[model samples]
Target: MMRWLSFLQLCLSLLLILPLPLEAFEPLTMGAIGLGAVGFGTYFKEYTYCKFTECCDDRSIPANIEALRSSLNRYLFGQHIVAQHIIPALSAHFQSRSTSRKPLVISFHGQPGTGKNFVADQIAKALYLKGSESSFVSKYLGQADFPQAGMVDAYKARISREVRNKLHECPRSLFIFDEVDKMPSGVFDTLTSLVDYNAFADGTDNTKAVFIFLSNTAGTHIADHLGNLMKGGKLREDTRLSDYESLLKRAAYNLDGGMKKTTMIESHVIDHYIPFLPLEKSHVLSCLQEEFWRWDRNPDSQKNKKLIDDIIDTSISYDRTHGLFAISGCKTLEKKVAVAVNYS
Candidate 1:
């Protein structure tokens, strides 16, 4: 395995290596506007690249499929998607005959970049191919608490109804609740009935369904990143750069530009795969000064390199101490994940 720098190089190399097609190819899949439809499915070309082609399932998986990857998807920069370990606990709740129990119910909460969306996307694909599916989006309601007078119940019913419809449409789907922590306590209690045994109104087999609750930095898991902010602006703490901070700020700033916007460099480092802080303006200018020289291939560029070299020379060495944050000069390892992210 290459260091983080190599990943950057790999991303660049792959882009260079891709074969440019002579003619435009039609996109493999098409979609429309519905909670039911907004996914990239059945899109990749189903080409047979092996000799024993019949053995390989010609069915093309979505390019985004990543259940097997052990790490957070690079695409989910600075987010805490549920690790594979937590998934099994939810899976355990559904080990019975489908007819014997109600579907499983689960909830998740976490900081903004803590991988909730990424985890949901992975679960959806897996369920599409294997199990039942349903989804709840907190953004559907206008308010964080969803206090729109019956709108919460309506959305809940709509999601439950959709789940019923989806069960009929596809035999299995993994129900995902995005931004679950944002829902009001009342609404969450109503939905969480399925999690508590005998809490369902019908007293049916709802417990059989797969259940999950995703929380970033919840309790001890969140103590480091979220620290006091989990108390909702009441608790004060010295620790910063948290998902809670990012989420609350987004909520407070909406379209006002008051909150610091999320950046690509912060996103990649937030994943814990790398440790990088968002670059300040001066840091960015210095970086640009260094990058300005990479463009010139002529010997006259020696001065430009020397300037960058001097800067690197005087700067604090990025060694084990730098790993305290999620970034480094080692941009050669995963050329893919690296180039995909703009750390500079």
Candidate 2:
């Protein structure tokens, strides 16, 4: 049996070494080749599935890194922190793929209308190569999925199953949990285990997955912290991750939310605690300009300038000194812009 297996391997190796088109191998032939090489044919099936059925899956490296970088830079407005920290972190992660290969766990903490969800969507689009609708990218809303008290266990089971299923299908899956501040605290602990570098019995490898948690619980705290920095003569742009990373983690772990008392933070598993600072007037102005360009409206027109001013005027503010503390951020800017554009 050993001699027969050795002969089969030699023949298969020679066959695979031949300069032949991939399409020339039929399904049965591919299965045979895989069996001879790997002792089973399932690996070949996964390759074919990725090659033909799931062309947009995140399992492969993006074809155009420069294009992705440009799009991310363009779309995620007012997020220079992302370009600074998140982009470099991702670059390192991708570059040293074989050495670490751990799950990229990121937590986005910020106020509403700050671009946490927007940036998350953009990242998924860039990595999956299929926009936001890719099968490998799974998103769960805390309010929608785990709203009630008694549903915590059920939610845990379902998310675990879904995550495992997706990872089994494609190891490079992306999971985003939006509004996680509303989720039950126990859920975080459940996910903590899965995010670790462990291979399941059913062939689900968690190391290649990415987990993102978005929360509003730490928003006010983050805003206050940044505001204090400004008051102390520290420029907002000069605020680094070290300034607010521990604060965000404290808020998430101590506050009444998904991560409260969870070991995920204590164990130091979360790769980054990204703070999405509250958008100021200039940032809001940038957002308005983006909206104008998105709708093909000329931003420099006199009418548009008045419209932008009106939008900024109407957005309620907390800080009377700078009038930059937009309570709603850019959330209401669209409707404000619409009213301005239509009425003008």
Where model 2 places Cα greater than 4 Å from the true spot, the runs are 1-52, 55-65, 319-323
Residues 1-344, model 1: lDDT tens digits:
34446545644754763465624333442112121132211111122232222111213212123352433343333322334333453344334434434454433444333345445556545433321222221123224434454465666576556554434433233445433334433344334343344443443344434444343323223333433343355332233334444443343223211011323112221111111222222333243342353333221356544544444445423323212211222222233222222332
What would the per-residue lDDT of candidate 2 be over residues 1-344, giving only the tens digit for each residue?
A: 67557656776876766578769989998787666667434444455556665653435437234565787677666666766777776666666655765788999998888888777877776777675687888999988888886777888788888888888877778899998889887876677778876767876778777789999988888788888888899988898889988898889999988888887887888999999888887888888988887778888999788787877776646554444566667777777777666677
Q: State the number of backbone clashes in model 1.
A: 56
What's the lDDT for residue 170 in model 1? 30
lDDT of 2 at 34: 68
How big is the positional error of residue 101 in model 1, measured in Å on the Cα after superposition?
A: 4.4
User: Local distance difference test, per candidate?
Assistant: 0.35, 0.77
TM-score of each: 0.37, 0.82
Best by TM-score: 2
